[model samples]
Target: MSELHNHADRVLSVVESSSAAALSRLAASWRRSLVRHGIDPATVQGPQRLTQRELNVLVESNDSFLRSATPRVDNLYALVGQSGCAVLLTDARGIVLQHRVNDGDAEVFSDWGLWSGGNWSEEAEGTNGIGTCLAERRRVTIHRDDHFIARNTGLSCMDAPIFGPNGQLLGALDVSSARSDQTEGFNQLISAMVEQTARQIETDFFRATFPKARIIVAGDDTREGSLLAVDQDDLVVGATRLARAALDLPTEGELRPIPAVDLLGRSEESPKGFEGAERAAVMRALSRADGNVSAAAKALGIGRATMYRRMKRLGISEKSH
Candidate 1:
């Protein structure tokens, strides 16, 4: 039997099996391709390409997203281009918006439909890198025969999903190579770079969405790029997808304006009552005045006697200030 027929048989057996619980990610994707997407594992057709008019419409609609992603994509290409890889940026639907390929490898990549305007959604192209990554909304490396389709078994693709500022699925960043010599280890390394670049693009897009808001690193976990956008009034205006998940905030729609201190759990650590507010104000004034009673009173717009009496009522020692 031919290799393509062998691959098709393998896919059919897995999809028809009842061991759903034991399926690996690749197996699950294969099942999805065969059952849900109705893609034939032995299919030899390339990806669907959009016309110039349709491509133009998509580009115009995603202008801001393209603007934010172009630089990062270029940087990633610079890092991996000489390795005979083609770098592609796709929309959330897995439509290729932009790609960078070396002159020597352009013909091969183009033939594989790794160019702009190619529709690579899992529903359209089976379980390839860009399609599977977007479908799963995570980082993935589809190496060689791991691909669901026999025709794509020659390629290795590393991809990471990019989320928008509002925690929406933006698209994916992909690095693909048809090099027969590319090993899984090298693909793993490129996967890390692809994930990192995708994250940088997410941060850039998030920051751009709230240009005037203060961007705060919300948590110590740097992998998700947990960030919050704070307004002048100290209200959280926006949060990245990981930040939302970490903080138990809504993952979509307009985030309710939450106090920065409350969200950060600082309010519980500090005072809460009206007297507590007064005490805090007094302490702040005193600190600003270098603990000078008269200066602090002047800063507070109160008489020195009143300031001293309030300090005593608040249980603040003169020496502690």
Candidate 2:
């Protein structure tokens, strides 16, 4: 007859009757929590937390990731901290590595185990924001009673998965609010911020991973951060997850050294005969010379008059540059 029992009964009914494919993502997560993880919806226990020593080891191993993510975590906190939200960054396994909360709200979040060292993996904490986002490898907003566990039903969590430069699952960025007044609309806005911040963290991590490589924005829409890292030889040394998915490139491990031009669909090898190749060569020389005809001809080891004749034949305008 209590609200907790009501919640448990609702979860049990959904898990028992609804097929996985027939349920919405949230309901499917509830089923996963109940069936796969064997979580009791009425359980009152908080999430498991690693000991200090274990947390230290995990932090040391993820040093670079935390370093790349910490600043963004602080920035996101600055944006949402006053709204009574706690910002947390978790590793791929949903172990919290960094946590930021205002002093006034720290105790509340800490009591709920939303602090560094807390493990919120789907296996440990069931259907919640950080856990579900990492489980699905996407953005998720678990608002209030949408949580699978009755104890967690009072919290609203927004999370986004962060992918590494190697296109591996890095972790998730989460913002959790314990405010009873939090609405679904506000959570939606916070979810957008979480996703954007996650993308920025990914970009920073990618750039740091290839400090000396030239970063190319490979797509028109930059929100996904579709980027390619090219070495001095113009070989693509790395790619973001979005870039890999868009270009049909391998998603993990060492990327094969593919030519950037080939990936961009601008290969210099011409199907059109020698004339096309010659034109391409002439264009390259002109580009390298910054549109100076004499310099381009000198670089090509040809007379200026010959260069002019070739440009005319190639139908390249000198003023086009």
- Tens-place lDDT per residue, model 1, 45-118, is 88899998999999899999999999999999999999999999999999999999999999999999999999
Per-model lDDT = 0.87, 0.87
Tens digit per residue, CA lDDT, model 2, 1-321: 388879988888877775653378888898899989999999988799999999999999999988898899999999999999999999999999989999998899999999999999999989999999999999999988888888898899999999999999999999999999999999999999999999999999999999998888874536467899876445577999988988888887767656567678664223256776676677667656767999999999999999999899888789643
TM-score for candidate 1, please give it. Answer: 0.81
**Candidate 1 collision pairs:** none
TM-score of each: 0.81, 0.82
Q: Give the range of the ten consecutive residues with the poorest summed lDDT in model 2.
A: 265-274
Best by lDDT: 2
Candidate 1 Cα outliers beyond 4 Å, as residue runs: 18-22, 267-321
RMSD of each: 9.9, 9.7
